[model samples]
Target: MASARKRKAAAQAAAQGAGGGVLAVKARYDAAGSGRRMRGWNPPTSGPNRAITGLQKIRDRARDAGRNDWSGESSTQHWTTNLIGIGIVPRLRRIKSKNRKQELNDLWDAWVSQADADGVLNFYGLQTLAVRSWLESGEVFARLRPRQIDAPLAVPLQVQLIEADFVPLLDADYWPGMPAGNTIRQGIERNKYGRRVAYWMYRDHPGDGQLSSAIDASRLLRVPADQVLHMFEPKRPGQLRGVSSLAPILARLRNVADFDDNVLERQKLANLFTVFITRTMPGGVDGDFDPLTNLPVDWGNDGLPLAGLEPGMSQELDPGQDVKFSAPPDAGTAYPDYMRTQHLGTAAGQGLPYELFSGDIKEVSDRTLRVIINEFRRFAEQRQWQIVIPMLCQPIRDAWVDAGVLSGAISVEEANDAKRVEWAPHGWQYIHPVQDVQGKKLEVDAGFRSRSSVIAERGDDPEQVDAERAADKERDEELGLFTAPIQPDPNRSDGDSSGESSPGRRPDSNKAKK
Candidate 1:
């Protein structure tokens, strides 16, 4: 027997081959009942026309199809929930300098908390909306502006989220009369080095019905790229516009949905009990009952209708008539398994775990789930850094800093570039918290991890944690509450952090005895 790797390779090779011989052999050797031949997969072969044209057409078709179908929004909704959810909102954190510049860090952190309370950042809504937009349309654009007087922050930044479709070409005639080095593709003006200089956006969304009349098509706004933060993960180097996340998997997702719906419909009908009678001795009784409800004298005895056979009441049958009462057969034992299998495929295409996609972890063990989540975390971090950080969070941070300085929430010293910031995205909930914590503790004790790193991993600021601990300690001391303070490992940082063994005690002569 061939190895699994060889079998998979052969199957892939057979699917790619253009000849029938390979397909026939593949079909015979296929492990599953169904062949691997995908529907609507006719790649052009051997010609000038085979250069893979119709990219825009493909994008348009995919978008239209996704909107028309439920799987597009439903799958995206599930992904967004799994990713951002209500608890996964990324919050801003001021990073402490390793050079031990503690005072400035403290000041910056105070300003952060104040600015957040001021609502100048609008970080909450920005993160939620940006993730949704990026997941749905594969891009989200944010325009920075000043906030209203009544806004939360004194000089808070106003972030206006824009959908990908709102921006249009200044001249529809394909980068009309531009210099050789510069080109405006899909409203994004990029220079010779492929650096985006600006974006030409419409005053209002073209699809906004209320503003459609007020919107001036000719009056395009030339916003600098710096002012307009475009968020997307580019698949190709020079690709300007974004294709929808559902674009590639739209067809497969829809097919699976339709199949599931079909199975469900059949199962519903199967559960319904239908009455069938073969009236052998009846000739004059030409009446039938309703096909669905078997109502009183609905098409009485006229026989089965041509349109459809619904479960309903039927007329009385004569004696010696053998009849079989049936509606639809059970969706069968393979129904749920088949759905799980299909959903697994869908999840793979979307780069999500089957559990996350289906929300079913009936048979998944803790170890298995952890492995799956660890893999997904990588994907999540990539999105956070590549898409959210630069395009949304960092820009918002910069604007917020300017607002803070203007509002006097942050002093000039704290407002300087030295007060670096870190955007800490929400962390994960462990499958087994106790076990996970034990492992983390061992990691810390083994000197592979730092206490601050562990706390940061749990979606918290270490500085904040330290401050809270100090406040608690003071409160406890005043109350004479002798609670054991959280003790750090003596060997941590190879014990170079402190000369004393205990971090909780002061370097006093009396406390040295304790």
Candidate 2:
């Protein structure tokens, strides 16, 4: 019975010990599970546990700062900062800074450099160097250094000559008091007064002077002397003995029988004279005559020689007859018959017949003489050619280049290189050589700008300048910047999954998204 009791107590103790060990193991498992659940439920608070919490705080701050909105305001800023941290932004910034510095330095250097080795800072020099650099480097910024030497563009002197001639007709020996039947002889003497009086009447009557003299001067001047030509009329009885008084009276008559015939003859004579005179004059061309013909022919189609005048030609006398004159159509309205009646009116202190004769003759004669004088003046002015000396400088070259006025380029080593080898504005083809102070040969480059080089060397920034210019253009546009609509690209795909829908096509539904 004692053995049985001891065994039973030991068995009880073993069962209790096994049960306790099992319970302890179960508690440990439950505690571990609870701790793990708690750990996952609430993030770590401190130490190594605080790492994830700190990251969460950072993310929260970023969200509050609007970094979470991809298409919102802060998106670009956020991306930029992130990119900068990765090193791209810093490198870009550095590159931009380097470029700006280099550009500035180049501009500064150009400004300091002398335009010419001679130390002359002419506008042409500045422009040439600037343009050259721009063409070579594609930059337009250049600065001009102040030149110590003062050089002004030289202005050439202009010279002209004018000539006037005085020819006296009668010598003292031909005085009216001399002899008898000589009176008839004296009246026909061709003196200065007779010629002058003849001209006066021709202007009024259009038929005076030896057809040859009238034609010669007309052809030389390239004008119609017929307008001033006068026909010879017999002088009235009791007229002054002086050639001037009587010659004028005779010139006034429109009734002179051969007036029209004389005009026709004079026209023929004038034309021949034009050809001869033009051939003798330098720079003379047919066009230099009258703007009408522009031909080198004389006034009259008739080939009259210039050498037919006798020495003693005086005014003649005959009985005067009743005269009537007609005025041209364009005569002013204020003067109904002024050109005809008044101009051809009777001479003062002369009879009715003499008066009518004097008026018509003098009027025609004066008109022709005036026309001749004017035509001569015109020819003289047109016969001149302007001579200009060009300086081989940068600014001048640039100006010519920019304007596209230069025709061709020649090297200094070439013959007559310094000359302006170009066609005239009127299309005259000619080449002019440039000469030095000592008349030595100088090489001239034909393609030159009078002003462009100067403008380029003045230190203008082409790109920035262009950009500003573009901005100005934009500002001047009719549409304001914000009001302008966006243009859609034709190649873009619409937001559709169907392959049939082209990127550029718009959706059929026009409704806005909900």
* Residue pairs with backbone atoms closer than 3 Å in model 1 (clashes): 118-152, 118-153, 287-300, 287-301, 288-299, 288-300, 288-301, 292-312, 294-312, 294-313
Superposed by TM-score, candidate 1 places the C-alpha of residue 296 at a distance from the truth, in angstroms, of 13
Per-candidate clashes, comma-separated: 10, 80
Reference-based TM-score, model 1: 0.69
What is each predicted model's overall lDDT from 0 to 1? 0.64, 0.29
Best by lDDT: 1
- Candidate 2 residue lDDT tens string, 1-514: 9999999999999999999987876877553454655566553444321232222233223333233222111222322222122111000112234554344334223432323424554333343333222211112222112222232211111111101001111123233333322211111222333322211111221223334323222222211111111111113332211111122222333333244345556666555432121123335333433212233435444764223223574423223312223332332364435434533342231222222223234444544644543443343223212101111122222322222212222222321212222211111111122322112111112234322232222223334455686676576443433222224334456664342333432333222221
Alpha carbon deviation, residue 228, candidate 1 (Å): 0.1
Off by over 4 Å in 2: 1-99, 102-106, 109-113, 119-488, 493-514
Tens-place lDDT digits, model 1, residues 1-514: 4699899999888777757766766767444334356444555453322231443344455556557755465567766665564433333344345433455444444434433333454456456767777777767788877655455644555667787767753323244334466766667777878788878877766666455433353656777887787887677655666666766686787687788788888888776766565435346755564333333343325674433444674545345555687857777899888878877877787888878766789988988988998998888778777877777777776776676666665566656563356666776777788998989999988889898999988888787799998898678777666563455565556534343544444434225564
- The Cα error of candidate 1 at residue 98, in Å, is 15
Against the hidden reference, what TM-scores do the models get? 0.69, 0.14
